[model samples]
Target: MAYPQELINEVLDYLDSGHSVREAERRFGVGHESAARWRRLRDGNLRANRPHPVKYPQDTVRLALGLAYGGHGFGLDEVAVMVGVSAPTISNWKRRYVEGGHMDIPEIDLGEIKHLSPDGRARMTDEELEEYIHKLELKAAVLEGTVKVLKAEGIDDLSNDEKAAIVDALPAGFTVTEALPEVGLSSSSYYYCKAKPERPDRYGRARAAIREEFALVGGKRGYRYIRQRLREREDPIVVSGKTVRRLMAEEGCRVSYAKKRRSYSSYAGEISAAPDNLVARDFHAEAPNEKWLTDITQFSIPAGKVYLSPVIDCFDGMPVAWSIGESPNAELANSMLEEACGQLADGEHPVCHSDRGCHYRWPGWIGICAERGIVRSMSRKGCSPDNSACEGFFGRLKNEFFYDRDWEGVTTEDFIGQLEQYMRYYRDERIKESLGWMSPMQYRKSLGLAA
Candidate 1:
């Protein structure tokens, strides 16, 4: 027997026009219960001949109900302010009207409410979801591998996303097996692919063993030399040249090489008669006046051809006396020797040694050494090793200092200063293992000699 608000209003209006309740009910299609309520309202209004009191303003009630229907979830305080009513009054009205199931009489139309369809709620297909999951897993794996490689290479700042991108860009079939040696990773991880007997179970352990041996021998031997030594002792394991090279590079191994040059004069006559071990003792003395070793070496300095006649002391290894001029004549050599002798201490008679250079063999230098009471020692002709100490020093000086230097910005004076500084550092600081692993100065101090 329920009736819509429209039907009730229609029956009530009909009754106001003096129609009976039964007639109004029949015309408006209202049930008996609804007709009874309309009859009561009509009779009461007729007796008073006055309009019925409005329950709420049409616009206010419509707005309140519209907000509720729109799912705004506004509280009574908020709704009351918008509808121009007290919060308590709105609360009571909401309880009496809405909670009590009173019919809503909306005066104006509210826009349509939107609800999602099944298709809209479920956008992604099973296939698409599976593809996304697969991509995520692949990306995660790629990032993990990239991080491993980067860490091995000592590059720690790479971002996770960048690492993932790098992993993705790797060759399609690339694996950690390919990266092992290049990135210096553990060998066990790499062995899963090749599983060759040649592959060492632990690369780091093998490398450590090789390095310890290399350190013990003082790097005087190359990889082949060390390998031969190891083989002679019946060590079954074999290492490749490339692996040794990489290890040597990592360990900062020192290497020596003779400068390459086209053959000029073989000095066959002098080589045939050259004596051995005539100049084995290394000499250095304190102050400029002490023990002197004189030698002549050729140079192509920018100022035409020049011969350097340097008289170095055997004590502190300082070039106390030097002369640079056009030709290495006996006069030039004698003059340098005389200059070094003049600077010597009182009663100090140093032994002057040299190869059979034409200047040293001449009577001028010979007479000077004899008059100065200096013991003259000569190496047999063409035997560079007979003057090994001086030759080795010159070779190192040229290769490590002079040969590598840029002469473009240097004047003669600048060159001299630079050479002086180099000699100072070489004597006082640079450690020479050949000199019992101490600097020349340190060696002198160890022997209780003044440096």
Candidate 2:
């Protein structure tokens, strides 16, 4: 079925704005193949595909209109019969030429004549064949050169500036118009990109500030955090978060970290009677030191295995205290808990939650909590998500720091020192999206809860 030209334009515009063709199908209620064809036609790359309705050449269209308007007063049906088209189609063409202006006429070429069948080329005169072969040579040259410019990706994946590079790289005699069709770029877009260097960069200062912020945090942040940091500056740089993301990609101010899951369980099977699940997967706390989650994660280095026991406050994901040692023993867990309790003021007894790990279930660990009036909470046997807030902290810690580093030949003591430094950095500097892109300490200061 024929769709209205206006509908086609609207769908193509939606596609040009960086949405996928499948999304356009659902949003515009158009068929997927039809929308994709419209996109290719708009990009001027309709080379191998046949036109759906067999579009007649512009010369034939002009001739048909000329005979209809020859002042013989022929009816629409007479013109239709002569041109071998329906009467309504003839009438529509006449209306489009007269009322809508001749410029609105659509010209659909059957691609370059060289792409036609052999018999189709035999019908052409020698001069026409020469012109077709000459055009083919130009297209071949452009395509060959553009391969280097595009690398392994398709031309449509490129930005306008990248496409214009193909146009600019054309041989001296070839014009930008000659190179555009090969690269699926329009003349207007090519010239617009050509003139871009003359225009002052609108995001110059903002790009510098974003890079500084991204580098300030060791490039582990996403764009939202970088944008929040920019806005928080004394002399703020107010820009869209999307703009920050694009600039980050363009300036190479992004981190690449691959995640690998490593599991280490301290569950020694019923060390003692576990406490009730007091937090019950609700990791939120209104005030600092109100709720605490603790867990032990083992990191295997070439030197040896290093274990970390951290007590994380549920309020803002702050690492309240952490102890790194060569072994995952009661000493590591006890020392971390002792340091965490030492920071609490009187009457601030937080619920200490943990998995059914023997370190937390042991008498020494319980005695410290009992002396400090800290309520103990425990997850059910072998359940990780029950104490997931603490598990999530370990996930982030390893993903951002441990997973990507090379720990070859480093002593356990040196590794512990480095881990200590990272703990300090994570607490004081690493921004969290849940805390409005502020570090744990920063968020506390913002709430007037810290010095």
Candidate 3:
């Protein structure tokens, strides 16, 4: 099967994160051979995962150098890494300073002292050079300690411009070269970064629009939804989800996940009135309405708690009918059942299944089943797995919609409307792996099962 570039990229993300190609295929529900072909993934920059080299601030280098010179056991090459300079350059600098009191850097022939004599002080007797180098190294260690303390006290996650500003703000004793190494920037990057104006965020316009949309949705919409909204605007501006996510993260605008509430069950010890488990956990259906699962889940709103009962068809995991009310009563299930049964074609006898709830066992529900010629199947007492298909629908519903928002200040009526709308979206928009990434309605329509 052909997969979209986005889907393939998702698989690549999994692969890049230390997962094997087989694992990526299984995780993203892609084909085995597709993921195994490594060459295809590397062809496009966006399709494959690329390495991001590490970047550091210049002041940080000073801290590393100070530690090494203070007998931290770091070699000259290691010190160079800490300061973002070449190992040879670090060694040369140390030697030149040691041998000539910081003046020998230009005077001495650079190649003559490639071999080290410990400290690099000039013209001093070996004895003097040794004592002076020790003093200097100890001082560097002290400087590193001070730099660490200051960095910890400063703003974390500094922007590039802020880092440059910090370097520019350094005290008189610290030179630009010392600060440059700490930030881990080459002279070119430093100059380019310094020249750019810092007044506006590069993504300022997009960030503003994203923040507005996020606030409108009660800060509950995720990056995908926000990106969709941006694309659907009247004067649609092009943008990517990565930008939205980054902006949201920078602004501390995040959607909080709400835990799902335990579902209410009316499972009593098997009674004579309850029907047999006819479906027997056989959720697979040969055609539409062959197996139907129904269940009720409650939602808490400021106005009051609301209950939703839906009859989901097993063939395509679509909701045939649903009913919502403020009260979790027998009427809610009965109304839902009536609507679902009405959806069946003439002479169709769907096996309507439900948990051993009082609503399903009640005479009202039983009478409807008998009148409509619908076959009734009940789950074993307290065995949710028996009617797992219906439970799965409820789990997905709550996870995607009801469990991720603040219902506070939302009236029972408005909440019910949105809940109903979400169910419609779930059936018509949300894609499923089993359905080949098609929504329930889309899957059914694709097979000419419905218009």
Candidate 4:
């Protein structure tokens, strides 16, 4: 089928970028034949537009016919080579001349036989060519319409009403007669669906509310959280999670995340004594201040590299305290630990888990934890999953905030400020499905654990 020119160009550009046609088809959802044909056309192999050498003298055909009919054991294949025409042409001449009692071989316009038949035959008329291209364009129009309105790949098993809606949404230059069959709808069914009054959208209000919530968070929240917020809003949109998901998708409320990059490591050769893995990858906490996981992640911008160290509570994934600095030194870890320790209630000592990083192994970090009566725990040598909870937090943070952004001209301080702002948003505004669609701060307030 003839894909839209924009999609064709995109696929071609992808191919030109050193990717295979198969890769382009998979990536762009284009058919392999169409992509390969377009590639051929791009490479100056215009098979469709190229002219075939069909010009031959009338005498050459006459000679070829005589050789075929001669009783000298000459076959049609042997005779066709005597002249400059194909075996099929000689056969056509014999059928039209000898069998039909014609005086002479009827002249056929060889130019009209330029296109290859669908069964690999070399005989297709102008009318057949037009019909083939028209069918392709119709199929393409149907595909484009389905993607635009129905958000689907093909019209397989779609209800008549849905198919009719797709037909109605078809672009200009396409007719209902052409689109109806492609979508598997009868003309009468299409007309009947069109004549019926339009059904009211059940999720119209939900769509508007979802758009607002999506924009409020700058499209960082997913549908599950939005569904919860919809139910909790003053004018609640009480709908199922599936309905909310559909509405958000229909409204184009999506968060585009980025691929993960190699994380910045702080593992310097053992600078001080290391503690045992007390948390043991069990990040779940029964109460606040039971376990705290701390890790330092680096963010590189055009201005410079900025480091962030945060002590995340095992309960509700809340960042109890965080410190941002230009360097990931002992002070960065120490200050964050101190701030986190300041929030503990009387006789509350949480196990602060960290990786085997020099900052965490230093005496400064040890002294602060020892004086605060906070327990220290460390992952094994070069084992990150031992501190997987903090690693997970960093993964979420980078995916949601750091990546997918163009930080071309921002200063280090400004980047730090933005990072700090995102952390606040993460704790107070961003909803988590694990927390029943409430932020960490909101979850804390719900439990009367925090103001």
Best by TM-score: 2
For all predictions, the C-alpha RMSD in Å is 38.5, 10.6, 9.6, 16.7
Question: Could you give candidate 1's per-residue lDDT for residues 313-361 as a string of tens digits?
Answer: 6655556667765666667787888887886666878777777666665
How much lDDT does candidate 3 score? 0.72
TM-score per candidate, chains pooled: 0.39, 0.65, 0.57, 0.59
- Single out the weakest 10-residue window by summed lDDT for candidate 1: 108-117
Model 3 spans with C-alpha error above 4 angstroms = 1-172, 181-184, 195-209, 212-219, 228-244, 251-253, 272-287, 315-317, 370-451
Error of 1 at 30 (Å): 99
Q: Which pairs of residues clash in candidate 4, taking residues 3 or more apart in a chain or in different chains? A: none
Clash count of each predicted structure: 6, 0, 14, 0
Model 2, TM vs. native? 0.65
lDDT, residue 335, candidate 1: 83
Question: Highest lDDT: which candidate?
Answer: 2
Worst 10 residues of 3 by lDDT: 103-112
User: What clash pairs does model 1 have?
Assistant: 283-314, 284-314, 284-315, 285-314, 285-315, 289-344
Report the candidate with higher TM-score, 3 versus 4.
4
In model 1, which regions exceed 4 Å deviation? 1-292, 312-321, 325-327, 342-348, 435-438, 445-448
Taking the tens digit of each residue's C-alpha lDDT, what string does model 2 give over 1-451?
8989999999998877645677688888999889999988889976774323324445546545655665545566776765556777656666766565753433333333232446768888888888777877776676777687778455556677887887787778777766676666778888888898899999999988988988776676688788888878998887756678899999998676666665678889886998899998999988889999998999888999899999999988999999989889999999999999999998899999999989999999999999998999999888889988888888778766777668898888998898899999999988787787788999999999889
